[model samples]
Target chain A: MEMIERYIYAVTQKLPQSQREDIGIELRGLIEDMIEERVGDGEVKKKDVEEVLIELGSPREMAIKYRGTKRYLIGPELYDSFLIVLKIVLISMFAGLGIVFVIQIIIDPVEILDHFVGLIVTLVTAIPQVVGWVTLVFALVDYYGGVQTKDLGLDKTWHPSMLSAIPDPRRRIKRSEPIVGIIFYVIVMVFFAFSSNFFGVYVFNDGGFREVVPFLNEAAFSQYMPLVLLLLAIFIVKECLKLISGKWTMKLVGYTVIINLLGMMVVSFLITGDAFWNPEFMSDLVKSGIVTEGSEGYQIGETIWKNSTRIIVILLLVGLVWDTIEGFIKARKK
Target chain B: MNEQEHIDKLMLELRRGTITIGVLSQLSVPQYGYSLVTLLNEKGVQVEPGTLYPLLRRLEKQGLLESLWDTNEARPRKYYKLSKMGNEVYEQLCKEWEGMVASLDHLIHTRKDEEDGND
Candidate 1:
């Protein structure tokens, strides 16, 4: 009887609140019936009850059968989508990290091994972190019985005519590419805005390698910081839009061309103003024996220093023209 | 893998689908979980008490079976019988089952004939 009570308790404990009492009473009656059938006119014994309970099987297993199907952290319905999202995130993480590792190696060729080792460590840690977070988000969505792919607005309004929305393979942008671009752009923007000294030439001086003499005049660059920030914001927005659409269209191309032209104009304005370069960088070059003061090398260096703004402006215009042409070409591609 | 295990697996699958019909057939009379199990086993349809009790509750919940608790004896017992809906459903299911068995029997015989001809 005690064993029966324990078994009933175990089974009922797993059941929903409203069904517990009814199920407990019903289970007890069934157990008593089985014991009565086994003992006949004899007094009911613990051993007889135990045997009946054993035949009934584990209380947890019985509870689960009553509960219909098993619960899952991520169920079958959302499993395909979960796997898709996980694959995209993991692959993007690896690719983005790989690109950064390559760029870091290029920037400091001496530390190539160190960068490679760091990349491996980052990938090892980041893969599981990304996978775990994605699983957790999917689990929460599943638990809440949130809307599925079939319930999407696109599914409701879907039509044969909308097949055009399926991007052409030739022109289609892989989503990870835009995401990686955005990440790279953000990193470059941050480095330039906060650590402008990193842009200059490194030289061994005094006892060890001294900080690079900054190429851009910090005070002068600070004045145009708002424009620089706006340009960065525009690039970020464009990349985000590209990621969302997963393909190029006329509108996106137009947007890219307009932003690039505006950026080129801003660069031209900064260059022509003659306040962009650090006046001190020329002296630092002479002191470092990079160029002899008043020598033929100094004359060439001076000429370069005076005409650098015009050279940069020409380069900016060329880049803008190339970008505009490339944009139209991509937009026109099948 | 072996012949006996293969047969057992096939039988398990066949029994899973037919157990509901077997239970419904015997529940025209009010029977408790253990009694229903005994009756089914006696009729050569073996059902575990674990499977039978939960199934009875599920059928009742689905409005196919109605239950009553009788405390007349020293111990109380919940007896289940088919509801009006249950009876109609059971009859329809029985007809469907008979049709399925007949069609399957004909298909099997036709296949057997082909195999015999080939041999």
Candidate 2:
């Protein structure tokens, strides 16, 4: 039993504290009742009790039973949506932690943590705008499709029946995987075609960025075009492939593209004849009247972040978009 | 044509007749697809959800079963129960089943000696 207590505690932690003790009491009582039924009156053996609990499976599963309606697997949400969200959350979390490990190794651990704190500040600062835009798009699409909020499964406390007037197609689309793949391949090609020479339309010649935004010079404004186009391409490819295959090939492609960009950055660093951070390079530039007294390392670091972050976010967002498209396809199937 | 004979052949009769009756009887209390499976399981009578769900739909279309959603849950579960005509039919079936078993057993035993002589 001490093990059972720990198991129960582990599950109960997921519940609200006010209800935790009550739920724990009920669960314990239920377990006792189950045990009694299994190994009856005279005297209950400790080993028998453990065996019974073990047979009942994990604390997570039991907690799910008590906490939820019997909608396992996909639950109440769109099955694909839940899957996509789960994939994105797990992948992003792991990747973020991995990147942090690399950062910690290169810099003082404390400095790395400070950098993390700064990154969080950047994201938290952008959340409202991002969330608002996403919600707007979702709402617009919903209303456009005559999706009654009343019909939405989200409103119900438990999973609701999805009633649609449209008759379900008996036969689903059946095309060869490679043929569908060829179409996707074409879509990606088209995407690259659109984005390729478009960013080069005006090389570093946009002075529209007002001065208020911290890095809002003409050069930054010009950089935005290529970054935004690349982001768009990622999003589009992800969306298209999601429609084609239930998989997120965009991330696979995005990883390759990001690595390519990183390679280019590395090449550019070589061409610039410096690591961009080597002390000798900074000092040489400083002596050449290229650097001023106020040229702190932080600005250079920020510039690198500003440039590389767009690529990382774009790649990851490609994953998210692909997942989103898959969700749509799955939802459409349902 | 009596209770004793009917009791003796009850198993054979139930194997064919009791199944339909049992299925029809449960519908009196509104049950959704999976709940019906649980109910049967708990009662030591196992029915596959695959079979039960489709059967419920067919029975509903045949006018023996009526189904509607219970919207109180997050997922709307479809509930099914017997119609009034279904209840009447079920009661009539139960009586017919009891009478048939009595006759069947009496017929089989009475004709046994005649069959043996022919053999």
Candidate 3:
């Protein structure tokens, strides 16, 4: 009886949550029937139970047979797109890293060997992080059904008439667009989350490359980290919508506009505020000799630095407008 | 790889479809999983309990069968019967199966005659 109970547990544990209880009950009854058939009026021995279980085959195989189909963390529906997005993101990471490496080597040729080693180390470390994050996002998107599952409420009964018309091929948003958007969002999110401390001014000296002036005030940046992460998450969700829809819709356009508006507000609040910027940035710039003191170049640089918040905000607005326009244009297509 | 193994593989494939029909045929009248297994085996269908249980569940999920737990029995037994839709489907499937059998029988008999002529 104990062995039978263990065997039932083994099979039912592998099954989905909803089916487990019913299946467990059915299995228990079935096994008991088989045991009775074998033993008749005699004692139900452990050997009879063992024989029955052995005939039923391994628990893993039984579970799989019951499942009817193989389960995936990122299921077959999203698997192809996941692979494509993964390849693109990894290649982009390599390219981005390579470009940065080249620029660094150019600045100070003496540290070429050290910089090459550093680049390799960075690539090695970053590859896992990138793969992990992409997989996590894709797995979550797969589990949650990407975009359409958001409004899948039990209150509304489905109708055949509610089925969307076949989209025009030309009107279909290319999958690469959303994939690239997701990749970009992931990269930005990763950079902000894990590597924000590297956002600093570096200068080479006798001590090798040193961060002479950190651009972000660590205390304040950490405080705003959650908000920054939230903004990126919303952006990723919007991109997920684009991925799932694979075509322009009014709903998607509206979502994109609202998300962009929300993002603009949050981002403006984050960057334009004193909490985000290093107060000593201008002084640090002068001290580092990247910007000179009391010269024509210095005067222009100073003026630009003084109104940098406005410039940054304007740039964000321009980007927001362009993105909104693009969404509307795509949605308007036949 | 070898003739026996090859034949066995083909034979398994052959039995797979027939097993579903066999199970559905007995299921016009409600029967519990173990009883259905026993009935099928007694008639020489030879389905594994492991295979039949899952197949029964799968058919139920497809709405070709409906199940109810009869707790009145000493041990609670889940009884399954052909649904209204299942009955219609089974009838249509039986027709198709008969057509296939007739066609195959003709083909096999003709092939045997050709082989005899060749000999």
Reference-based TM-score of each model: 0.59, 0.28, 0.77
lDDT of 1 by residue, A271-310 (tens): 7777788878778888877777889998897788768746
Q: Is candidate 1 or candidate 2 better by lDDT?
A: 1
Which segments of model 3 are wrong by more than 4 Å? A13-22, A39-43, A64-70, A94-129, A144-219, A233-246, A290-292, B1-14, B58-74, B83-85, B105-119
lDDT of 2 by residue, B1-119 (tens): 79988886885566434556667878888986666766777887755443454456557767988878666764456778899988898899989988998999999987997899899
Candidate 1 Cα errors over 4 Å, as ranges: A41-47, A94-128, A143-334, B117-119
Using lDDT as the measure, the top candidate is 3
- Put down candidate 2 lDDT per residue, A2-42, tens digits, no spaces: 76677679768866577587556545544555566667776
Clashing pairs in 3: none
Docking quality category of candidate 1 according to DockQ thresholds: medium
Q: Which tens-of-lDDT digit does each residue in B5-95 have in candidate 1?
A: 9999999999988999999999899998878898999999989988888888889999999999988977678899999999999999999
Q: Which candidate model has the greater DockQ, 1 or 3?
A: 3
Q: What overall lDDT goes with each candidate model? A: 0.77, 0.51, 0.82
State the TM-score for model 2.
Answer: 0.28
